[model samples]
Target: MDGCTGKIEQEMRAGLRAFFTVPYLLDQGMACLEEKLREALLFGRLTVLHYRAFGGTGAGIYRAAAAVEFMILSLDIIDDLQDKDNQETVWGRLSPDIALNIALGMLTLSQHLLLTADFPHERSGSAARLMNEQVLAAINGQTVDLLNNIESEEEYMEMIRLKSAGLLAAACLTGTLLATGEPLSEVRTYAEELGIAAQMKNDIRDVLNWDNKNDFWNRKKTLPTLYLLQSISDEQRWIADYFAERLQLADVVNRKEEIERIMEESGTLLYSSVRMRTHYYNYLDLVGKISLAPEWKEQILAMAD
Candidate 1:
């Protein structure tokens, strides 16, 4: 890890140790924290990057990053539990009740860390409010996603805006609010664009996977899946039948290669790629409009990658 990310991870570990008093909870929290630390701390890095980009100088910014990471970790566990996927994750392997309790505790700890960070009272309040608002928006989005009733590209976009974009926006806005005591509208716009692009990329990958997480297997109405459904030939009607529940997984278990070929031939992948690229470029364009040094802009762009 880079120096900044290493510092953020250190702070995250400290926060877990300081707040989790019960031995069992501490062990579980630490296990989940280590699991998350194995990957890039993208959201936490966004918080720190924005803080630095906005001229924040306090050491408490690391604490703020920790808070962001803790909240994200909690939400990730909740998402996996809700989806009943990612069974290899530490939380997924634990008892559902234990995992749920760990998630709840970490969530509250995130708020505590944020509210208690060494910032001006007004800045802390503003940051907390922004964080809570975005978190609530994410929860609402996740609720809509769980219902699995999205039927249009517009609905899918809206759901992802709330579920995915909201978290990214919150991470950026937290740092901005802590530094400037005002939420930067430009930061929000670019962050949301980035979030949408990232989620679309994930959707494309999920649709291609031949596992429980496969969007087609789950009948998920992602943009790519919707496109596939709309563009399939009569010979590919079995795909539609499976989605509509007229056919079952048994009917298509051995057709993975055929389905992949269909996805490629139907222009579904290209369409999804083009749409994802549009949002990604929009994010870069919006970031360019922000009043920052060229190097800062470059750094932010690198972080997105």
Candidate 2:
């Protein structure tokens, strides 16, 4: 791990140790948290990177990154629980009630850490408010996603902006606010675009895979799947039927090869790739406008890769 990420992890462990005093809570929470820590701490890294890029100094920034990461882990647990996917995870293996309690505890812990971070009083308050607003927006977006009522590309874009992009914006803005005491609008814009691009990449992966989390199997209306549904020929009517629930998984489970071929020949994959690239390029353009040193700017741009 990067040195900054290591610091954030240490901070997160410290926070858990300080707050989760109950024996049962400590055991279960630590297990779930360790699972999350094993993955790339992307949000925490973003917070630390932005803090340095905007001239922040000292160890306080690591606490802020830990707070952001805690909130992210809470949401990840909730998402997996709601989706009933990724049952191999530690949280997934536990009873739902226990996992839910741990998630709620982490959520509160995140706010507590942020509210008490060693920053200026006024700056800490501002950052806390921004974090709450973004989290609420993400919750609303997640509600819409659970309903799965999206009918157009526009709705899908809006949902992702609120659900996925809001979290990234909050991470970047938290560091910027702590460093400069101002929520930089340019930073939020680029972070949101980057988040959308990242979601597109995940959607592409999910649509191609054959598993419990496969987007097509779940009838998820992602950009690629939406395009496939809209542009499929008469011979591919079964794809639309499966999405509409007129056909069951059993009817198409053995047709993965055919579906992959159709996704390629119908230009669905290319279309999705183009859309993801468009957002990424836009994010890069916005990144170029930020006033940072050449080396810092390069480092920020390299994150997209």
Instruction: Give the Cα error of residue 217 in candidate 1, in Å.
Output: 1.3
Question: Looking at model 1, which ten-residue stretch has the lowest summed lDDT?
Answer: 1-10
Highest-lDDT candidate? 2
83-184, model 1: which lDDT tens digit per residue? 997899999999999999999988888888889998998998888888888789999999988988778899999999998988998999998888888899
For model 2 the TM-score comes to 0.97
lDDT against the true structure, each candidate: 0.90, 0.91
Q: Residue by residue across 1-305, what tens digits does model 2's lDDT show?
A: 25987898898998889988998889989999899888878898888899899999888888889999999999989999998978999999999999998899888888888888889989988999998998899999999889886888998999999989889889999999999999999999999999999999999999988889999999988898889999999988999999999999999999999999999999999999999999999999999988999888888888788
In model 2, where do residues sit more than 4 Å from their true spots? none
Supply the TM-score for candidate 1: 0.97
Alpha carbon lDDT at 281, candidate 2 = 97
